[model samples]
Target: MNQNNKVKHPKGLTFLFLSEMWERFGYYLMIGIFTLYLKDVKAGFAMTEAEAADLYGTFIALVFLTPFLGGLIADRYFGYTKSIIIGGLMMGVGYCMMAIHSLPILYLSMTLVIIGNGFFKPNISTLLGNIYSTPEYEDKKDEGYNIFYMGINVGAFICNFFGAALYILLGWGYAFLAAGIGMFLGVGIFLYGMKHYRAFDVKKGMQQGDMSFLKIVMVILFPAVIAGVIGWVVPTQVLGHALIGSPSTDAFIFACIPVIYFYGSLLAKADKSEKRPIAALLTIFAVVILFWAVFKQNGSALNTWADRYTDRHVENPMAAKIFSGLSLSQQLTMAKDSVPLYDEAFRLQKADGKVLQEYNYPTYFKNVAPEKRLAEGTQIEVWATNISQSINPGWVILLTPLIVAFFTWLRKRNQEPTTATKIAFGLLISALSVLVMIGAVYSGGNGAEKVSVFWLMASYGVITIGELFLSPMGLSLVSKLSPVRITSLMMGGWFLATSIGNKLSGVLATLWDTYENKANFFWINFFLLLFSALVAFMLLKWLNGIMREKGIK
Candidate 1:
């Protein structure tokens, strides 16, 4: 029985896995269709590509930002279990509220989700860490987290199918409502397994030399709010135009200033023993910002690629029939409509205040060869674009076990790379992933024709490997290196980097319409990632030395 127990994971892990899976199901389901919903002319807001991408960027940035405060609050006031419950409930309601058509209600719902994520995201992970701190599970903590991460991707992978079916069969509202139901289901699972992790729900209120709750509110939160408001209002009101991609973008960047300062101050005030570790973590955080900036594009720019450029038409009659019966695909007619003519660079052409081409065709057929063009009334069954959002997580689900085995094999031979080494290599490999898109652009004749969905699949496959190497390792590095009292603060720094990177992704995506040569746009991403990898390689020795000082791999 003891030997069997050693081979098996704890019961709590199962519950945590189910809970996180459901929570992600709700979150990713909403994200999968968000921009598409925003751009729908009749049912959605009819936002332009830039407008939708900007909003999507801001929303996701805030979603990551709140976890800083949420984790802090859970540690100081609410315990992990309670905070997770509250956050989950808030998010559940927020998803349901998204079903409402009112703009005001949508904003309100978004705020709830941002705040809820702050509470739920960090606390649950922390609780898991606490559970694994026990002697029996300590050796297997990394395995546990890898398992937990897979649960997140599992939810992410399947939610798109449900979302596509629900939206196709009913409407966007029903799909959003399904997200809310998923969140509630997650909360229920967490509650049912409460006893398993209840012992680890301990909270440490105020500690010696720690700032009081009121002080934190006054110095950090209040200042951030004021700065954000000023950023939102001042740029357009004073300058007559946005200083950034959008007002929300400006606001988020400005709000981050105070928080950035706070983290900086920690480095200044940290003890000699703590100083080097904090600085090392901060340097890493800054470098990985480039990674998130590129990866987060899945929801915006990539979604657009899948929607407008990919060959999603289901050619197999049986497959098309299955998709149609399941409401997983939409049947679109190639009806003629007004579309603008393009110049040599593919920019829209105009003459005397009128579009050059009066014969408008559906956008999906814009790049098809004239000889291959279908009749005006011909109908095609095409898979929903949102389904493409699942590709990364699907890759995650498929590759994780293999990745774990590969790393485990290395560990046994004493040949596993250091965390820093893995991250540096991850960045380099991610840079290579951009070449796939460059290939895709060439294959599609710079958007003059549709390319096979296989290109997107291959790109996602490469990047998922990069993500597996860097993302989990970063989290573990923080736990291994941070001073006990300041660990939470360092964690906040990681999220800050992620939030900033997410916003940058949006900013880059806004330029999608401007780039006549789409390859140029992907090239920019490649360079950014390559630069980050170079920086990581230069710092690798020093970072590894710090790990040695801390006596961790």
Candidate 2:
């Protein structure tokens, strides 16, 4: 290509960015409302917080877990482009099917998404690495990944507003249909750039001694199913109150054992030159689980915090009008006679030791003073709960450029931190973000009152910095360090760690009601990240040494 015609990066990057952007828009839109849908009294399943949290955790965990098989299949049989198209179509159809308001269909829809994500997630990332592998783009690989990461957040940031608008204006079904449309759009965008990625869409066929596809299915998939079944059917009384919080929780943890072993076997069997780097990646993967466990709670525990504890009522008429026009406001009718009573989990607040019978009580006003409360039966508008899902992605959108610029400045000054170092600091910084929530809890009088929405925004801002440091670095590290032949497979391993942490996040959220004092709950999250940070810091020298040996930054 002529110099003027040649792009600074691959033309494929633009296509991949838009494609992934739209895909995430669909995925996040569905996730942003998932728990809310499950817990809605009239329109939803009316599940308790614990029940909803468990299902949400299991759904996200499986969503990330399938990439291992997908990457393996793409590496061995299908190419990246084909797998991406198939996965995208499957997810689109699945999202549409979710519009059917039946429990069986809901589960079936979730299954389709889980399987679809497997085929789509890791391969797209691996393809991006392949495009950047050439000498022309090699030096800019990290920057390329950062830019791509920003695209994901862009989709994530924008989707909630659309989801909120659709849910408010049309209904739940239309909002879900919108997710499906976004996925189909993503697939169309990917196909448009197929020719650009073709040169780099090389598949690694079966290597010598690699297991056959059938054997992998038999050894990994079949055993996982059997183990999950056993975990699910085994009595909670057998273990005395559920071994790991719930049957699904137990099943997922049990299922992961074999997959964890599979990754370990890969390390054990690698040639000497590849062994240490694989080990380093695995070590980092193990530690970062804590970061994800806390971060993923934005969907479950944090969503609850936003719904019941944050001050979401709009006092400014202009702001209310704007939000109303966007279909992002929830109208509450204040009725003193309709106040809800506390459930067993305390999710609903009670008055005068009497259980209230009314449905759709305005629980958001539970903490308000009597003098400030609206007249009985008067209607007031507040922003919807799921809109809070936008905060982290909003931070990502604002701070990513600043973060990239700061690191670039450090690089120019020869003072840039190593990727491993950035991740270590990321863990520590994320731990501190948990402290912001602890402060919020205490400031709000242990959930007895509504706290300022700024607390949630500040917490998200702090954690977004940590996320920028760690998440993209992990992806870049896999690309930089993995054996070229197993790049996609190792990416799968990175996501496997994420999968486990995501499930654990749900497990923790299920316990949200167990803590009478909510500040203690956040303190526990802080300590988990703190411990992980300590471990990462201790291993920093060894990890950097491995990078140096491989001649990478």
Candidate 3:
């Protein structure tokens, strides 16, 4: 092997990077406003917090879940480029359709996104790995992935501002339409670089003894649909208060049963040489589910905290003016007007007499002292709640270079941690980030007052370090550990873990009002991550031994 000071990676990386960035721009833009859209009394479904969180969780989970089937189709029949193109178009149309404002149309739009993501997500990732498979690029694989991951965060970081501006200026429909436009741009970029990735777009086709596509539909798809219907229709009384909180929850879990079994069958059928690596990957996947269950709350639980509990008012006149000009600041008028009185769970508080509607009921000054209240009819400028979603990606952009450098330094000294060790440590670090939220809960007097925005920023900063450690490593791990024949399939398996944990995050968030002491909620998240970390730590030596056996570091 020749070592070169200046390694030239495939030119295709640039195209993939841009395409994925735009795709994520569209996706994150929509997600940044999803719950907000669902909960808006004037323009949205007017759902309660729990209702919105449940639906958000289910939607995102399905978005990730489809990639499993998408990867299979891409690997066997469609090839990466075709699958990606089709998926992008579907998603673009879906985002545009979300502007329709009908409940049935909303569901239809979500379904398109879910299906499109299945075709788009895993295939693009697998295509990148294929480009890096040659001996010349093998050593740079991790670095390539890190660069690619940064592109994702870049898109995620900038999208919220655009979303906020569009929502404020033109309304929700225009904001969603912007998401569609972003997807179309991404598709266009992908097509421009078609020539570069064409060689790597070779389909795996069917292997000897492999299940046929038709068989998969019959055995996996049909069973999953039937199971979902059964779960949805079964009476709660018969099952003892809904197996997992709602009909969709039960249905999704039931549908996943066959999928989980399918992965198990993969392990059962693998050759002896492949068993240990597959088992190791599966074990890691299971442990990481808890990590995502906690981490993914950035969208739901944390978003709620940012909206209702954090002090978002811009005290500085210049900053306020600038943000307001950009349509990134929300103005609340201090005048008597009709407003819904919401309970702890954000449900409309019902009353018999008059149904009193206080102006700006969940007012910014609700927890402020009398001296702090603005004069009547005054319009106070506050930061938009959804802008808080940018913090994590902002942290990612700032920290990725440093993390890469630190790991590179360790590699130079021959002291770099194994991927499993890195992941275990990531979980532990993320667990500690929850402690910051715990502090915020206490400092805010258990949600009786608004806390400083720095607390949220600090927590995101801490968790981002953990994210840089785990997320990219998981992608690289799958590339390194999976058998060549089933690489994309295993990537789908990784995403399945993510999908399950994402749904669990929503479930946990739905229980937000159940805890009177808000600190207990953060505590629950902390313990869950801590438990996962401990399990990962306990298995570290064993996992590392397997990695050594398979010649992966």
- Any runs in candidate 2 off by more than 4 Å, and if so which? 1-11, 129-144, 198-200, 208-210, 235-241, 267-275, 327-358, 483-486
What tens-digit string does per-residue lDDT give for candidate 2 at 459-512? Answer: 999998999899989988988999876776688788889999999999999999
Ranking 1 against 3 by lDDT, winner: 1
What TM-score goes with each of the models?
A: 0.93, 0.90, 0.91
Model 2 residue 334 CA deviation in Å: 6.5
In what order do the candidates fall by TM-score, top score first?
1, 3, 2
Task: Give the TM-score (vs. native) of candidate 1.
Answer: 0.93
| Each prediction's number of clashing residue pairs | 3, 0, 0
lDDT for each residue of candidate 1 in 174-209, tens digit (9 for 90 to 100): 999999999999999999999999999999888776
Give model 2 RMSD, 1 decimal: 3.6
Give the distance in Å from residue 475's predicted Cα in candidate 3 to where it truly belongs.
2.6
Clashes of 1: 3
lDDT of 3 by residue, 70-164 (tens): 98899888999999999999999999999999999999999999999899988898899889988888888877887888889889988888998
Candidate with the larger TM-score of 1 and 2: 1
Candidate 2 residue 188 Cα shift, in angstroms, is 2.2
Error of 3 at 521 (Å): 0.9
